[model samples]
Target: MADLSSNAPANQFRIAVKKQKVWLASALILLVTALLAPDQATESLGFVAKSLTQTGPYLLLSIGIAAWAVATGADNLIARAFTGSPALMIFLAALAGGLSPFCSCGVIPLIAALLTMGVPLSAVMAFWLASPVMDPSMFFLTSGVLGFEFAIAKTLAAIGLGMAGGFIVLALAGTHVLHDALRDGVGNGGCGAAKIRSPKPVVWRFWEQSERVEKFGKEAVKTTLFLAQWLTLAFLLESLMLAYVPAETITSILGGTGIGPIAIATVVGVPAYLNGYAALPLISGLMEQGMASGAGLAFLVAGGVTSLPAAIAVWALVKPRVFALYIGISLGGAFLIGLAYQGWTLL
Candidate 1:
């Protein structure tokens, strides 16, 4: 009636102009502030530098994992591979989890996607426990800070716990739980239900048409966006840890002659999400102040496994009971490993 369609483009243009002005003004303000307040600017710069130093490894790891996920379509590949074999799926999940660079928060979306694709519960459990510990970036950080021997021990312990946890989950809950939880079914096309329905081809027809380019571009953007969100959150967490938590406090809490300190460290680390890279400085400080190797290892394991974000994500996707079981097993396994390390040292 009022030429509504003709005005739509004009409205969009106005909105775009408004957004541009807002951004421009914000940038100008920030620049002026930086010029006027050298101390605040320097402090901000220092904060960024410290955060990068602490969480750079994890950021690199996230990039590597994201690249792999994009290149191989890991979610789809895994779904296809574990179609009928629950046990095999469980093992693969653990392996994938171990290799994945995702932090606790990032791992959840992938896990949820996998579960929706009909992956076995055991495998999902394995991935849940193993991903944080087996990250390559974190491994590099550990090797640098904790030494090669401790790194090896940490890796082995993570894999063992993942495997053991998978079996325990499978035995207690049965494979049907997995099937029921992941009711969407498995396989390449079937796994990507939401994506598949969008009138887009799953496999790239590189030679067929130029439209594939657009599809790939869209996918790249999606992947980047997803990775960026998680990576930013992780970086922020690292910054907080560096700014607030003192090296001396961490050492005093975890270091001592009795098993009480080790146990306390494990418990404290569960809800406290910490970057493996940041732990290096803290560990170095502790060691300089006389903390035991075993105690440090315990802290590392607990921090990696008991991430609150991961636990919440797992709970949302899986049963509350299953989530509780996972937490219990992971905590118990970490404690046992710590105890073993302590005993070996005593021997």
Candidate 2:
């Protein structure tokens, strides 16, 4: 009736806007601040600019590493971790989960494939627990936003949580507790299945191939834009948070070390968590407001593993009982890791 074909351009524009929601949101925040709080708007802009410039080198390094992984196909090595004995596989999987380049969502297809392939749940659980928490790009970004020590501690936490989850699942594997781990019809196929099922050999000298050079450039640009947009939004929000949120509020809730604050942080981390990259600047702002290091650690670890996106992906792939165990391991292991880091800081 109303010339539907004529509205194609409008529909396309709406789709484009939806795809760039983060960027649009960032722009909207700035526009509102400019109109409502003109003076603070300038400061916010300066803060975001300065912060981005400061982290520029680390950002570049992270982008390069990610691009290199793509070009050389080093990520394929992640599949190799499942080939050994249960104990050995768990060890390797945990380490790979810490070091591999896959994000939580990106690792989903691989996880599905591994489960379908009859890989033991122990090692799969280990990788699943750790993969969401840390990786090469994440390490450099955390180091830039937080500190080297903090980043290193987080990496260790990732590996440790994976190991703990793996072994616990290992012990329970024989108990029928983990029976029917995956949901029916869940692991048929998905986006990254081919990479896991038919991995290509790594070409360490990827520069020699014209296609690899093109891939490296494309990946570098894609990763750079992704990190830049998220960091921009994060820093902008952080500046506003620092300006508005009172110091005593954060301190009272998440400060002054001990198991109490750490546990609270872990619980809060789940719902309060934003994108991992965005959360870094906000957490830095919170810590500046007197949030304890242990609380910060717990918040990050828990959020990485149990954030809504990660949790939903897991739920879609696994049965309810297995999902419960996953959550249990994530929270429990995050708490222990937080305690360990807190003790380390004290000493």
Candidate 3:
């Protein structure tokens, strides 16, 4: 009779090999399909390339922060900082989230790092929801393109919504709802359930360890590949959206102050909002065409918060429940903000 223990390792290896072959075969089929649809493939590839180009600076920022955190043992420092006060930490996390310039996908590595180091998911969610909406550049661009009122309102909403998300998540903490996102820190006070752990070495200086750079390099490569695959899928789906969704379909409402128009704007914006920069011009055009200020505000907010790329990035990191909560925060925030703007305008 064969010894079960002796074959366990070999059986596991075989299973892993089989999974890889399945993936390889799937990739080949996709390659063949792409070759058959050359134009569609080119368009999709172009968008992916463009997305990578746009994401480079943010990716560098994420990688830099991750590396520094590992080298200086900053994850532990952050964990300790989180221990100070839950209320304040939520506010600060949301505030930091607003200040980031990275797109949603670009922030994934950093989010992963924070979570891996046992940072609380609620704080991470706050940062996650706020970061994509407006950074300094986005702020300036919005002010220039959409006017000070629109820009200021969005800035306020980002922070408020971020804090709102944090509080809601914190309130729901220690429940079955947060089980997946709370992850390692489940019952602990924001990533303190277990010891702080950085993905790579936790040396004082990067150069102190001979293998630190190599480890970081490998991690960077892995991150880049993981992001590339996900971003490519997002780009492809967005391209289909752009190809099919009619421009007039969005402008039909004339940006009215009513509930219907506002709701329409939010719905359209979820699928329609592309890069913030690109959306500015389109929104401007829509506004000029009698789009209501409230509708525009809702559209911009919803678009930025749940942009396809950002949502995809989010889904890649967190559980389904967390993703749903994030969407709820974005949508609810958009609705309230739009309502306020309309009321101010007496719409």
Q: Residue by residue across 37-116, what tens digits does model 2's lDDT show?
A: 99999999999999999999989999999999999999889878888799999999999999999877778788888887
lDDT digits (tens) for residues 71-104 of candidate 3: 4543443333244467887787777767644557
Pitting candidate 1 against candidate 2, the one with the higher lDDT is 2
Question: Highest lDDT: which candidate?
Answer: 2
Q: Which regions of candidate 3 are displaced past 4 Å?
A: 1-83, 182-252
For model 1, how does the per-residue alpha-carbon lDDT over 1-347 read when each residue is reduced to its tens digit? Answer: 68899999999999977746533543454466478865654554465456456655655554454544444444444333344577876676676666655667766556665566555677778878887776765565566545667778888778777888988878876554433553232233342344313323234334254554454455556544543443333433333444446757756766665787778767866755445544554555465555666666677777777765666767677655666677888888887778778777777
The regions of model 1 sitting more than 4 angstroms off are 1-87, 174-253, 345-347
Candidate 2 lDDT (Cα, 0 to 1): 0.90
Clashes of each: 1, 0, 2
Pairs with backbone N, CA or C atoms under 3 Å apart (clashes), candidate 1: 90-123
Return the lDDT, model 2, position 185: 92
In candidate 2, position 127 carries an lDDT of 93
